[model samples]
Target chain A: MDSVTALGLVAAVLTTGSFLPQAIKTWKTKSTKDVSIVMYLLLCTGIILWTAYGFLIGSIPVIAANVVSFIFTFAILALKIKYK
Target chain B: MDSVTALGLVAAVLTTGSFLPQAIKTWKTKSTKDVSIVMYLLLCTGIILWTAYGFLIGSIPVIAANVVSFIFTFAILALKIKYK
Candidate 1:
Protein backbone atom coordinates (compact mmCIF):
# COMPACT_ATOMS: atom_id res chain seq x y z
CA MET A 1 0.00 0.00 0.00
CA ASP A 2 0.96 3.64 -0.35
CA SER A 3 2.31 5.67 2.56
CA VAL A 4 -1.00 7.34 3.25
CA THR A 5 -2.79 4.03 3.39
CA ALA A 6 0.00 2.61 5.47
CA LEU A 7 -0.29 5.49 7.90
CA GLY A 8 -4.03 5.04 8.17
CA LEU A 9 -3.63 1.30 8.65
CA VAL A 10 -1.05 1.78 11.35
CA ALA A 11 -3.24 4.33 13.06
CA ALA A 12 -6.19 1.98 12.80
CA VAL A 13 -4.27 -0.97 14.20
CA LEU A 14 -2.97 0.89 17.20
CA THR A 15 -6.29 2.48 18.05
CA THR A 16 -8.29 -0.69 17.56
CA GLY A 17 -5.80 -3.03 19.20
CA SER A 18 -5.72 -0.81 22.28
CA PHE A 19 -9.14 -2.14 23.21
CA LEU A 20 -8.19 -5.81 23.02
CA PRO A 21 -6.47 -5.99 26.37
CA GLN A 22 -9.31 -4.22 28.12
CA ALA A 23 -11.88 -6.50 26.58
CA ILE A 24 -9.92 -9.55 27.64
CA LYS A 25 -9.47 -8.16 31.11
CA THR A 26 -13.14 -7.43 31.41
CA TRP A 27 -13.93 -10.89 30.19
CA LYS A 28 -11.57 -12.54 32.63
CA THR A 29 -12.35 -10.36 35.60
CA LYS A 30 -16.06 -9.97 34.92
CA SER A 31 -15.64 -6.40 36.02
CA THR A 32 -17.28 -3.55 34.23
CA LYS A 33 -17.51 -1.28 37.19
CA ASP A 34 -14.49 0.70 36.18
CA VAL A 35 -15.49 0.61 32.56
CA SER A 36 -18.05 3.34 32.04
CA ILE A 37 -21.40 2.03 30.82
CA VAL A 38 -22.13 5.35 29.13
CA MET A 39 -18.83 5.30 27.38
CA TYR A 40 -19.30 1.82 26.03
CA LEU A 41 -22.83 2.51 24.91
CA LEU A 42 -21.76 5.61 23.05
CA LEU A 43 -18.68 3.95 21.71
CA CYS A 44 -20.58 1.00 20.32
CA THR A 45 -23.01 3.28 18.61
CA GLY A 46 -20.18 5.38 17.23
CA ILE A 47 -18.36 2.33 15.97
CA ILE A 48 -21.44 1.16 14.12
CA LEU A 49 -21.81 4.56 12.53
CA TRP A 50 -18.16 4.71 11.68
CA THR A 51 -18.41 1.30 10.07
CA ALA A 52 -21.33 2.46 7.98
CA TYR A 53 -19.54 5.65 7.06
CA GLY A 54 -16.51 3.65 6.07
CA PHE A 55 -18.66 1.46 3.88
CA LEU A 56 -20.29 4.44 2.23
CA ILE A 57 -16.93 6.01 1.55
CA GLY A 58 -15.30 2.77 0.40
CA SER A 59 -12.38 3.11 2.73
CA ILE A 60 -10.84 -0.25 3.47
CA PRO A 61 -8.81 1.07 6.36
CA VAL A 62 -11.83 2.59 8.03
CA ILE A 63 -14.01 -0.41 7.32
CA ALA A 64 -11.46 -2.95 8.55
CA ALA A 65 -10.66 -1.02 11.69
CA ASN A 66 -14.26 -0.25 12.54
CA VAL A 67 -15.33 -3.87 11.95
CA VAL A 68 -12.83 -5.17 14.45
CA SER A 69 -13.61 -2.30 16.73
CA PHE A 70 -17.33 -2.99 16.42
CA ILE A 71 -16.80 -6.55 17.57
CA PHE A 72 -14.65 -5.45 20.48
CA THR A 73 -17.05 -2.73 21.48
CA PHE A 74 -19.97 -5.13 21.25
CA ALA A 75 -18.12 -7.60 23.39
CA ILE A 76 -17.49 -4.94 25.97
CA LEU A 77 -21.08 -3.75 25.76
CA ALA A 78 -22.39 -7.27 26.30
CA LEU A 79 -20.11 -7.67 29.28
CA LYS A 80 -21.22 -4.34 30.62
CA ILE A 81 -24.85 -5.41 30.52
CA LYS A 82 -24.17 -8.88 31.89
CA TYR A 83 -22.05 -7.66 34.75
CA LYS A 84 -24.34 -4.81 35.59
CA MET B 1 -19.92 20.41 3.26
CA ASP B 2 -20.72 17.68 0.79
CA SER B 3 -22.39 14.39 1.65
CA VAL B 4 -19.17 12.43 2.06
CA THR B 5 -17.64 15.09 4.25
CA ALA B 6 -20.82 15.37 6.21
CA LEU B 7 -20.90 11.64 6.78
CA GLY B 8 -17.29 11.64 7.88
CA LEU B 9 -17.91 14.59 10.18
CA VAL B 10 -20.87 12.88 11.72
CA ALA B 11 -18.93 9.70 12.20
CA ALA B 12 -16.04 11.61 13.69
CA VAL B 13 -18.28 13.55 16.02
CA LEU B 14 -19.93 10.44 17.35
CA THR B 15 -16.76 8.50 17.91
CA THR B 16 -14.81 11.40 19.35
CA GLY B 17 -17.63 12.76 21.42
CA SER B 18 -18.21 9.34 22.93
CA PHE B 19 -15.11 9.84 25.01
CA LEU B 20 -16.23 13.12 26.54
CA PRO B 21 -18.36 11.62 29.29
CA GLN B 22 -15.64 9.24 30.30
CA ALA B 23 -13.12 12.02 30.46
CA ILE B 24 -15.43 14.17 32.48
CA LYS B 25 -16.23 11.32 34.83
CA THR B 26 -12.61 10.52 35.27
CA TRP B 27 -11.87 14.15 35.98
CA LYS B 28 -14.63 14.27 38.55
CA THR B 29 -14.16 10.87 40.19
CA LYS B 30 -10.41 10.89 39.77
CA SER B 31 -10.61 7.18 39.03
CA THR B 32 -8.56 5.48 36.40
CA LYS B 33 -8.74 2.03 37.89
CA ASP B 34 -11.23 0.69 35.39
CA VAL B 35 -9.75 2.63 32.54
CA SER B 36 -6.99 0.65 30.90
CA ILE B 37 -3.58 2.30 31.00
CA VAL B 38 -2.38 0.32 28.03
CA MET B 39 -5.40 1.31 26.03
CA TYR B 40 -5.02 5.03 26.68
CA LEU B 41 -1.33 5.00 25.97
CA LEU B 42 -1.78 3.23 22.69
CA LEU B 43 -4.82 5.28 21.87
CA CYS B 44 -3.10 8.57 22.55
CA THR B 45 -0.25 7.58 20.31
CA GLY B 46 -2.67 6.51 17.65
CA ILE B 47 -4.59 9.74 17.89
CA ILE B 48 -1.44 11.73 17.35
CA LEU B 49 -0.60 9.67 14.32
CA TRP B 50 -4.11 10.00 13.06
CA THR B 51 -3.95 13.75 13.44
CA ALA B 52 -0.73 13.84 11.49
CA TYR B 53 -2.21 11.58 8.88
CA GLY B 54 -5.25 13.77 8.66
CA PHE B 55 -3.08 16.80 8.25
CA LEU B 56 -1.09 15.15 5.52
CA ILE B 57 -4.20 14.04 3.73
CA GLY B 58 -5.96 17.40 4.08
CA SER B 59 -8.99 15.88 5.75
CA ILE B 60 -10.62 18.50 7.93
CA PRO B 61 -13.01 16.05 9.52
CA VAL B 62 -10.26 13.63 10.42
CA ILE B 63 -8.08 16.39 11.75
CA ALA B 64 -10.83 17.94 13.80
CA ALA B 65 -11.94 14.64 15.30
CA ASN B 66 -8.48 13.38 16.13
CA VAL B 67 -7.52 16.70 17.73
CA VAL B 68 -10.44 16.50 20.12
CA SER B 69 -9.77 12.85 20.74
CA PHE B 70 -6.12 13.52 21.40
CA ILE B 71 -7.00 16.04 24.09
CA PHE B 72 -9.37 13.65 25.84
CA THR B 73 -6.93 10.77 25.66
CA PHE B 74 -4.19 12.97 27.02
CA ALA B 75 -6.40 13.93 29.93
CA ILE B 76 -7.16 10.30 30.63
CA LEU B 77 -3.51 9.39 30.36
CA ALA B 78 -2.53 12.10 32.79
CA LEU B 79 -5.14 10.90 35.22
CA LYS B 80 -4.00 7.35 34.80
CA ILE B 81 -0.54 8.41 35.83
CA LYS B 82 -1.64 10.64 38.69
CA TYR B 83 -4.13 8.13 40.09
CA LYS B 84 -2.00 5.10 39.52
Candidate 2:
Protein backbone atom coordinates (compact mmCIF):
# COMPACT_ATOMS: atom_id res chain seq x y z
CA MET A 1 0.00 0.00 0.00
CA ASP A 2 1.03 3.57 -0.59
CA SER A 3 2.31 5.55 2.38
CA VAL A 4 -0.74 7.84 2.62
CA THR A 5 -3.11 4.91 2.55
CA ALA A 6 -1.06 3.12 5.14
CA LEU A 7 -1.15 6.22 7.30
CA GLY A 8 -4.90 6.41 6.92
CA LEU A 9 -5.21 2.78 7.95
CA VAL A 10 -2.99 3.34 10.95
CA ALA A 11 -4.98 6.43 11.91
CA ALA A 12 -8.19 4.48 11.50
CA VAL A 13 -7.02 1.61 13.66
CA LEU A 14 -5.77 3.88 16.40
CA THR A 15 -8.90 6.00 16.51
CA THR A 16 -11.33 3.11 16.16
CA GLY A 17 -9.48 0.68 18.39
CA SER A 18 -9.32 3.28 21.15
CA PHE A 19 -13.01 2.85 21.80
CA LEU A 20 -12.77 -0.84 22.58
CA PRO A 21 -11.42 -0.32 26.05
CA GLN A 22 -14.11 2.19 26.92
CA ALA A 23 -16.80 -0.13 25.69
CA ILE A 24 -15.36 -2.97 27.69
CA LYS A 25 -15.04 -0.81 30.77
CA THR A 26 -18.59 0.36 30.55
CA TRP A 27 -19.70 -3.20 29.99
CA LYS A 28 -17.83 -4.59 32.96
CA THR A 29 -18.72 -1.74 35.27
CA LYS A 30 -22.19 -1.08 33.90
CA SER A 31 -21.48 2.55 34.65
CA THR A 32 -22.01 5.04 31.89
CA LYS A 33 -23.18 7.80 34.17
CA ASP A 34 -20.24 9.97 33.36
CA VAL A 35 -20.67 9.16 29.70
CA SER A 36 -22.87 11.81 28.22
CA ILE A 37 -25.90 10.50 26.39
CA VAL A 38 -26.05 13.50 24.09
CA MET A 39 -22.47 12.98 23.08
CA TYR A 40 -22.88 9.30 22.31
CA LEU A 41 -26.11 9.90 20.45
CA LEU A 42 -24.48 12.46 18.24
CA LEU A 43 -21.39 10.28 17.90
CA CYS A 44 -23.39 7.25 16.86
CA THR A 45 -25.25 9.24 14.24
CA GLY A 46 -22.05 10.78 12.99
CA ILE A 47 -20.33 7.41 12.76
CA ILE A 48 -23.14 6.07 10.58
CA LEU A 49 -22.75 9.06 8.29
CA TRP A 50 -18.98 8.59 8.33
CA THR A 51 -19.42 5.02 7.18
CA ALA A 52 -21.58 6.25 4.32
CA TYR A 53 -19.00 8.84 3.42
CA GLY A 54 -16.29 6.20 3.53
CA PHE A 55 -18.28 4.07 1.15
CA LEU A 56 -18.80 6.96 -1.21
CA ILE A 57 -15.10 7.66 -1.29
CA GLY A 58 -14.43 3.95 -1.86
CA SER A 59 -11.79 3.89 0.85
CA ILE A 60 -11.71 0.46 2.40
CA PRO A 61 -9.76 1.70 5.37
CA VAL A 62 -12.28 4.41 6.16
CA ILE A 63 -15.18 2.06 5.62
CA ALA A 64 -13.69 -0.71 7.71
CA ALA A 65 -12.62 1.62 10.48
CA ASN A 66 -15.98 3.34 10.68
CA VAL A 67 -17.93 0.09 10.64
CA VAL A 68 -15.98 -1.16 13.62
CA SER A 69 -16.29 2.25 15.18
CA PHE A 70 -20.02 2.26 14.71
CA ILE A 71 -20.32 -1.06 16.48
CA PHE A 72 -18.33 0.15 19.46
CA THR A 73 -20.16 3.46 19.66
CA PHE A 74 -23.47 1.70 19.33
CA ALA A 75 -22.50 -0.66 22.10
CA ILE A 76 -21.66 2.23 24.38
CA LEU A 77 -24.86 4.00 23.44
CA ALA A 78 -26.88 0.91 24.18
CA LEU A 79 -25.14 0.36 27.44
CA LYS A 80 -25.73 3.95 28.48
CA ILE A 81 -29.42 3.61 27.81
CA LYS A 82 -29.65 0.24 29.51
CA TYR A 83 -27.83 1.31 32.61
CA LYS A 84 -29.59 4.64 32.84
CA MET B 1 -17.13 21.41 -3.82
CA ASP B 2 -17.87 18.02 -5.30
CA SER B 3 -20.39 15.71 -3.69
CA VAL B 4 -17.80 13.43 -2.15
CA THR B 5 -15.86 16.24 -0.61
CA ALA B 6 -19.01 17.86 0.64
CA LEU B 7 -20.06 14.62 2.19
CA GLY B 8 -16.71 14.31 3.86
CA LEU B 9 -17.00 17.79 5.31
CA VAL B 10 -20.42 17.03 6.67
CA ALA B 11 -19.16 13.81 8.21
CA ALA B 12 -16.27 15.64 9.78
CA VAL B 13 -18.45 18.34 11.23
CA LEU B 14 -20.90 15.89 12.69
CA THR B 15 -18.27 13.73 14.30
CA THR B 16 -16.18 16.60 15.59
CA GLY B 17 -19.11 18.62 16.81
CA SER B 18 -20.40 15.66 18.77
CA PHE B 19 -17.56 16.05 21.21
CA LEU B 20 -18.46 19.57 22.24
CA PRO B 21 -21.36 18.60 24.41
CA GLN B 22 -19.30 15.97 26.16
CA ALA B 23 -16.56 18.42 26.88
CA ILE B 24 -19.04 20.94 28.12
CA LYS B 25 -20.77 18.36 30.25
CA THR B 26 -17.53 17.29 31.78
CA TRP B 27 -16.49 20.84 32.42
CA LYS B 28 -19.77 21.74 34.06
CA THR B 29 -20.04 18.55 36.03
CA LYS B 30 -16.35 18.26 36.71
CA SER B 31 -16.83 14.53 36.78
CA THR B 32 -14.87 12.28 34.50
CA LYS B 33 -14.76 9.24 36.66
CA ASP B 34 -16.34 7.09 34.01
CA VAL B 35 -14.20 8.54 31.27
CA SER B 36 -11.48 6.02 30.57
CA ILE B 37 -8.02 7.56 30.57
CA VAL B 38 -6.64 4.93 28.21
CA MET B 39 -9.36 5.66 25.68
CA TYR B 40 -8.83 9.41 25.69
CA LEU B 41 -5.07 9.12 25.61
CA LEU B 42 -5.26 6.82 22.64
CA LEU B 43 -7.87 9.01 21.02
CA CYS B 44 -5.77 12.13 21.49
CA THR B 45 -2.74 10.42 20.00
CA GLY B 46 -4.80 9.13 17.10
CA ILE B 47 -6.20 12.58 16.44
CA ILE B 48 -2.75 14.11 16.29
CA LEU B 49 -1.78 11.42 13.81
CA TRP B 50 -4.96 12.08 11.87
CA THR B 51 -4.11 15.75 11.63
CA ALA B 52 -0.70 14.82 10.31
CA TYR B 53 -2.21 12.35 7.88
CA GLY B 54 -4.67 14.96 6.67
CA PHE B 55 -1.82 17.33 6.03
CA LEU B 56 0.08 14.64 4.17
CA ILE B 57 -2.99 13.76 2.09
CA GLY B 58 -3.88 17.42 1.42
CA SER B 59 -7.40 17.08 2.72
CA ILE B 60 -8.47 20.40 4.19
CA PRO B 61 -11.62 18.89 5.59
CA VAL B 62 -9.74 16.16 7.34
CA ILE B 63 -7.15 18.55 8.65
CA ALA B 64 -9.70 21.05 9.92
CA ALA B 65 -11.81 18.33 11.45
CA ASN B 66 -8.90 16.73 13.24
CA VAL B 67 -7.57 19.99 14.64
CA VAL B 68 -10.87 20.75 16.31
CA SER B 69 -11.16 17.13 17.38
CA PHE B 70 -7.73 17.20 18.93
CA ILE B 71 -8.59 20.26 20.97
CA PHE B 72 -11.69 18.66 22.41
CA THR B 73 -9.97 15.38 23.14
CA PHE B 74 -7.13 17.19 24.81
CA ALA B 75 -9.58 19.12 26.93
CA ILE B 76 -11.11 15.89 28.11
CA LEU B 77 -7.71 14.45 28.79
CA ALA B 78 -6.76 17.45 30.87
CA LEU B 79 -10.00 17.30 32.80
CA LYS B 80 -9.59 13.62 33.46
CA ILE B 81 -6.13 14.23 34.76
CA LYS B 82 -7.10 17.16 36.97
CA TYR B 83 -10.18 15.46 38.38
CA LYS B 84 -8.58 12.09 38.80
The candidate that wins on lDDT is 2
Model 1 chain B poorest ten-residue lDDT run: B4-13
Clashing pairs in 2: none
Q: Superposing every Cα of model 2 onto the true structure, what RMSD results?
A: 1.1
Candidate number achieving the greatest DockQ relative to the actual structure: 2
Please state what fraction of the native interface contacts candidate 2 reproduces. 0.71
TM-scores for all predictions: 0.93, 0.95
lDDT of 1 at B18: 80
lDDT of 2 by residue, B5-47 (tens): 7777777888898888889989999998888899899899889
lDDT of each residue in A1-84, candidate 2, tens digit only: 888877777788889998898899999999888898898888888888888888988887788888999999899999999998
If you assessed candidate 1 against the hidden native complex, which CAPRI class would it receive? medium
- Going through the candidates in order, state the TM-score of chain A alone for each one: 0.92, 0.92
Residues B1-84 of candidate 1 have per-residue lDDT tens digits of: 788767667777878988888888888888767677888999999999999899989988789889999998898889879987
